[model samples]
Every structure is written in C-alpha cells, then in structure tokens.
Target: MRRLTAAVAASLLPGLMVIAIAGLPVPAGAAEPYDAYADEACDGYFDPLLLERGSRCSGSRERSCPTVRHWTPRRVSRQLPACEGVAQAAHPLHAERIQSSYLALRPDHGAPRAIYLMLHWHRATAHEAVNYLHLQDLARSRGALVIVPDVPGNQWAQSGSRNINQHVAWVDAVLADAQRRYGTGNLPVYLVGLSNGAAMAMHYACARADRIDAVMPVALPMYRSDLAACSFSQSIGYVQVHGDSDRFVPYRGNLWFASAEQVYARMRRNMDCVDAGAKAARLESPLTPVDIRYGDGCVGGRRGYLLRVENAGHTWPDMETLSGRDRNPYGLIARNFDATLQGYDLLQLAAGR
Candidate 1:
C-alpha cells in the first residue's frame, strides 16, 4: 500500500543515452521499445512502460501511441469488470423545493467492488446535465457504483451556511438515495473531485472521515488553518494530484489554504509517517516527469501520495486528444502522461483492494 512499483519505475530508464562524440539525440531504433515519435508526436505515442510492466504489445499496426498505457483496451479490460455500457440515473434530493440532481453509473454487467463518488467543479450557472457526464466516464472503468452530483445552484452549499454542515448533510441524503436503489451492503466509498469540487471532497473527508475510506483530490487546496472543525480521527488514505504550473490554484500555499506540498505533509502526519523521513521515488524521464514520495512506516493501512506533474496546468493530466477536452481555455493541460490512472491505482492501494 505504501510503495507503488509503477511500470515506468520498474523499467529504470533502459539504455542510458551514451552520447555520440557530436552531441545529438540518440539514433533512431536504439532501444527495444523505441520512442516512435520523439520530436513531433512523442507525447501522444503510447508507452507500455508507463502502465503495466508485463503487457506484451498486441502488435496492432493501427494502435496510436499518442496516449499513455493504463487505459489501453487490453490492460483496462483486465483491470476493470466486464462493462460495455454505463447505467444512468437522476434522483431528486431532499424532496423539498430546494432540490439537487445526481448521475449514477454502474458497470454494464457485474456487481461493483466499491462505490465511487465523483464531484464536479463549481458550475457557476451551468445547469446542463451533459456538462457532468464526463465525470462519470472518468470513473466508469473502475467498476464501481459511480455517483456524480451537481452542486445545487452552481455551488457546493452556501459558503456562510455554517460551512460543511449543510454540504455534508446534502451529500448523506444523496448517497442514501443512491444506495437504496443500488446498495451493495457496506462497500468502501471512494471520493474524487476536481478544482472547487476537490475542496468539497477534502472538507467532506475531514468532517466525515469515518464515512469515507479514501479520497483523491486533484488541483485544489484547502485552508487547513480554518478546518479545525474537520477531524482526521480515522486513518484515511489520500492520493492528491496537482500541477506545479497550475494557474488557477497556485501551487504555493496562500494565507487561505495549505499548498499541495503542505497537504501531503499533513497527510503524512495523519498516516503516522516518520517526521521528514519521507523518501521520494521517480521515473527517470527527461526532467524527472513523475516523482512519488513514500511516507515510511505509515500505520493503520494508510497511504499518502504526491504526484507532481511538471509543466502541467490546472487541468487533469490526461490525453487531450482522446478526451477531447481542453478544460481550461488556455489549452495548458499536460498530456504527456496519464494522471487519472496514477491516482486511481493509488486509491486502490489505499483501499487495500
């Protein structure tokens, strides 16, 4: 649960580039799994070394290497349950005039192993349901009962309405409704969020830590100083993702919230990690693309992770071409790797699955 031997980590930078007398990029076809398109399309080309270590290439000439490997048809097919389609639903919240909506997605064919709640970013005024289906799709392959909810009135609960008390109550109602229809008696619940929604997930994990088994928050930080009401009474494994180059959520800790590193440090403390004794693991790519720091001697089956994607923006670090989303107007998404699976696998580790 602590150390993830990611395939790339196992590969260990095969065949170090011994430069020619005249300094230049290594000659073409110099390695076994050659980077087919180093100059123009290297970022897009799929690398098996990135996802699973022993997955032999299917040898399909039609395959595109533009994206990373975790979501590959073969590996994903093996990792997730047999799911050909997603079941959708919309249930009313509270039954009063003050209403909330949610989308429920189940695997095409099997009993789910767990329940995953994916919260979307603040919508402001975007009430359209279609704007949030992508959130369900992001977690569809995980073979969980995925519930994606829309924050009523483009907000996760009024800010001054006694903080998370209102938000947590609303969440409990939504989950209870979803479970009545598709309940799998006491399954571990995993929460995922992005941007503002990430803050909500963090607050939920803190306020109601007992109810949550694990949480994955991407690109958002909370004001730790203000969260005295929140408690980590239970050991909860958290896998957080953030871009150092994020423009919207500054990587640097502000007066309001703790920075990404600060959050990880706090996680280590909660998980009982040795003080400042964390060890960093990396995939030796150009500029050290992936850095995973292990919190040594974490007690109570708890895990803490920090996936620092270099040069990544405020968007999720997924392939833009396949996902067809430039979430940010600036098109600053970091597509060189798959951050989704990185966090997903970490959640699995945290849950002891």
Candidate 2:
C-alpha cells in the first residue's frame, strides 16, 4: 500500500514496504489498525474531515487527530524528520539547501523510455535541483525519461492548513502536464527521491497509488501507516537505501520515524494485513550487501527490495565514490553504489515491465 508506489511514507504523511532489512514486532503504543488511529469520532475515520480538514489525525498514528503541525520554515529551518542539527550541513552535499518555492524539471530525453518522477530533498534550491541530472544519461541509456523536479520550496509541505493536499494537487497538475506534453507520460510512472523528497514520493504514490508503478527512496522513509490504516489500497513495489554510518538520518531510528530496519518490519506487518505473505531474504549488490524479498502481497505484483549500506554516510548511493574534502558538516557520499541503474531496474520490476 503505497503510501510508496516503493519510495514514500511521510510524517503527517506516512516506511518502506521491504527487502530483508529487519523484522520488528509492532511498537509499544503504536496504533493497531490504521483506522485505529481514530480516537475521536469527529467524522468518518477515513473522511476528509478527520483525514484532512484538520482532523489532527496525522501527527502520530497513535493520536485520534492531527497534532497541530508547525510550519517547517523552508530553507535552513525546514521541519522534517530532522538529523539533530546535522541536516543543514549534510544537505548541501546532496542538494544545495537554498530554498526554492517552485519546482524545476528536465525534459525526457526521448522515446522508448518510461517517464520518471524524481523529487528533491527538503529545502533544496533550483540549482541543486539538477543534482540528480547524472541520472539523465543513465536513464536515457535505459530508455527511460527522467523528470527531476525540485519540490515546491524544497518540500511537499506537510501541514493541516490544507497545504499538503494543495501541494499534492499541484503535483497532480504537473503529472497531467507531463502526460500531455511528453509522450512518455502515459508509460508507467515511477517515482524516485532522496531523503525527504523520497518520503514525498512515497506519500504521493500512496495517495495516488492508482497511477504509480514503482518507487525508489534513498536514506528516508514513509509508507506503512496508510497500509495499516487501510489495507485495501493498491500495492507498489518498494525499495530504499540506508547507511549505518549516517549520523544524520542514522540507520538507528526514533519513535516518530523509523530506521531502515523498522521501516521494513512495518511494511511486512502491513502487508500481512492484506494477506500478502511476502517473505524476506538476503541479496548482494555489486557495491554492497542488499536483500531482495518478494511476495504476492505488495502492489504492482508483490515485489520489494532494500539496500542496506554497511557503514556508509549521509549521501546518495551512487556508482561513484566521492573522496574530496568539503566544508559541509555532513560527510561524503557513499562510495561505489549504483542508485541510478538500480533505480531503473527496480522500477522495471515494480511495473513488471
């Protein structure tokens, strides 16, 4: 239940759906079913009122309504699953943290490629928006059109001001535009993101799971809650990358969010709710150790994956090993992992293409 279509899961929004990361029993004080998050009967459990309209149900699944969400100021002050003061420095390395209120996109190189929707991390700048352009050549090589966009002002804007809904609607418009302008729009749409953008990708997929085919998130999570709340939603192929060495967004998680392991566990239980008994296993990648688990329980044909970067840092899992010294507080990118190629391949599997 995409709440990833493989990449998303958000705060007011939604964990990974799988790959043999780790298994976890439900957390203490965790909501039972997704609807179990409903403590007050203000409106229908899934209705827009409780679900949206400031129902206050979005904070923690344990609460019946949404906790008053404070606006995470864009740029340096972004409110997210923060990295304990390390994000501001760690971010510039991946995508410049300068705030950009609008989105930027790169046209699909050509035909014979699937259309990809790529989102940027929170508080990213327009210039930084091109950070993932390296995937451009790679995607074209795979006959896929990559649409990398800076999330409006660096975030999908998770707020009860009807802000998140509006942002999602805006994305809907953008997808429609991509469909009409780019011929590849009709092709299976795959979402990919880094960090917070990855969460956005997953949340967007869950809300609009019908249209999404696959999702690839690196170093962040948000996907299982909705599945727990409403297992009737569509299944989506899920995959993610995480590093134990990451001080920021560490593999070790918190109560509000999940570590890579917890995300995988939650996904498994959520799938069980729908009777999709996807099993787990270990698989090795060229760069590092990974686990490839599959079952008929997930969306787009019950496929799932997870790449556990051993002793890596707050960086994109790319084929290159960044070794130069930088002033940023966060460290360097993990050396020798091919996120680009792997992402494309995962999408293929997710879409069963």
Candidate 3:
C-alpha cells in the first residue's frame, strides 16, 4: 500500500486538479464510488460538476449533461450514549446530560464502509453543516455513516472554553455510539471540520488519535493553545484547506490562532514527515489554481497536506453558492476548486483507503 499509480489516483478524484508531491509517491487507495446525485439531469446552463455541491441542475431548454437525482437529506436526530464524569460526593457516578441533538446520515442500504464525523463552525448548527458540505449525499453514495454533533452553544471547546474535559468526553461518546450502530467491524473513522470546528478537529485528533485515522480541517488555522496542548502518539493523517484571504480566521496569525506556517510545522512534528515543498495543482480555472504543499515520509505511513486556495475567503471553496443560512460573512469564495471533494480525497489518501 505504499504507492498508487497515477491512473488509479486519478480515478479516485475524477475531474479534479492534482500535482504530485515532490519526492513522495501517492499512497495506494481507491475512492469509494460516489453517485448519490448521479441521476439528476444536468441542464445546458449549469455544468455537471455542481451536483456534488448539492445544487439543483439548472439547465436550459436543451439537456446537455447526464441525468441524476440528488439525494435529499433526511435529518435524523439521536441522543448519544451518555459519558460518565468523575464521581461527586453524593453521586458515585454522574451521566453528563447532552441537551442538543446530533444528526446522523446513513446509506440507504448495506453496511457502511467507514464512519465520517463532521464538526460545524462556531455559531453554526449540524443541519447547516449538512447543507454546506453536502456530506449527506456523500454518505449515501459511499455507503458511509456520517455523524454531526451540535457542540454546546454552537461552539466547540478550546483552551479557554468551559467544560473542556466534558466536551471531549461527549465527542468520545458520540463516536462510540456511531461505531456500535453503523460502523463496519474495525471501520476507519475520518474527521472533517470547518473554522473553529477545524481547530476542534485538530485538538481531538491529537487527543484521541487512536479513534481517528485522519482529519481534514478547512477554513481555519491551528490555535496557539491547541498547538501547545497537542501531542500525537499515533499517526493521524492531517490535511488543511484554507483561504489566504479569510479575514475571520486569517491565514496569518490573529491574536489567538497560529499562522498557516505554524500549523503546518506542528503537523509535520506530529507525523515526523520530512520537507515536501509546494506543488501547484491547476484546476479548470487557471486563475485560481490551488497551491499544494505537504510533508513526505511521515511516521506510520502518514502524510500532511496544506491546500492554499488562491484569493479565496472563509467560505467553502469552489462551490456555486451557499444556502442562506450557510453563508460566510468573512471572505470571498473561490470557484476554481471543490474543497469538500478535495478534503474527502485527501482523507481517503491518509486512511490508505
């Protein structure tokens, strides 16, 4: 599983831009076929690529692209198995009550190939995450179980956040519940997040690397606090996608968050990867090609990649439009690359498929 042929790698990421990392060969893996929206008919007006973004095909009088049906998400709510905290004086064992509902999306049929955990950004809900990433459709297509939990107050815990221990415990409980219910035996778990949620993903991935095989954190940098606290014992593959123009979570360091360079350095330290320089991957639109950089020869066959979306903002990259509730107030959206698809592809590579 050390190397993948170019043809094989290309098959996994159909119609997307790619450039090989310097000196590092692509890992062996095949993307599970994603056809959840394959049946929606593409009209003459819109390109077929918009389907993955969960956009309804808006075509003209003449049909041009292939027909497909979008898999509408049915938001299912469930209570996570309770996590116990340190015993109090009167109560020997206390079950931490989770008042918020978590969302789960399962394949229509068959056992899941893997489990995907998605963390939404600050001030965002689980449902908004579904619409923003369209991961529900990915779940349906890949026969994967996707779980999204609503963090307390729509904010994930950070170093300054209250109940940090409790928040981590709740996340562990959610993974346990999802594994028992939908995970195939020994399924590889992948974690993906946006903004503050991205920071949380980095935190949790290092804290509980045994549970997560890889992580994709989009639109935010690693927090200085998180870097101080994180120490990875296992190889949890790391991939970051950030827009350099993101004002809300600046690619450069703000008061709290570290710069993109700092984050990448930390990831390299965690995985023990040697220097792999920037490689340009041109997309359909040459004006906004993604700049890819990574570390190679990481410990335990791991890798870390940072995708710098040119001139992009806080919004998810390369999508046609965001739903009203999912719009980002901070930055401009890049229309050249698909962040969701790129994240997923990177996740699979990290997991060794």
TM-score of each: 0.69, 0.60, 0.69
As a TM-score, model 2 comes out at 0.60
- Tens digits of per-residue lDDT, candidate 3, 204-319, equal 88788888888888876555776777788887788888877766566786766687768877877887776654233333322334566654577777777777776666656643
Model 2 stretches with alpha carbons more than 4 Å out: 1-110, 126-129, 159-162, 221-232, 268-300, 319-332
List runs of model 3 lying over 4 Å from the truth.
1-95, 183-185, 276-280, 284-287, 319-328
Give one digit per residue, the lDDT tens place, for model 1 in 1-353: 11122211211211111111221233366444433223332232223233334322211122221231223333321122222355555666763334777767676677777777776655421212122223334334556677777666555542234545777777777777777778665878888876666777877887777777888888774665634444586877778887777655567765455778878777667656565555555433332155556553566666677777665555555422223433334224443445443455567666545
Give lDDT per model, in order.
0.54, 0.47, 0.58
Model 3: worst 10 consecutive residues (lDDT sum): 83-92
Candidate 1's TM-score: 0.69
Compare candidates 2 and 3 on TM-score and give the better one.
3
The TM-score of candidate 3 is 0.69
Candidate 1: RMSD to truth? 11.9
- Distance from true position, residue 148, model 3, in Å? 0.8
**Model 1 worst lDDT run, 10 consecutive residues:** 11-20
Tell me the deviation in Å of residue 275 in model 2.
9.3
- C-alpha lDDT (0 to 100) for residue 315 of candidate 2: 54
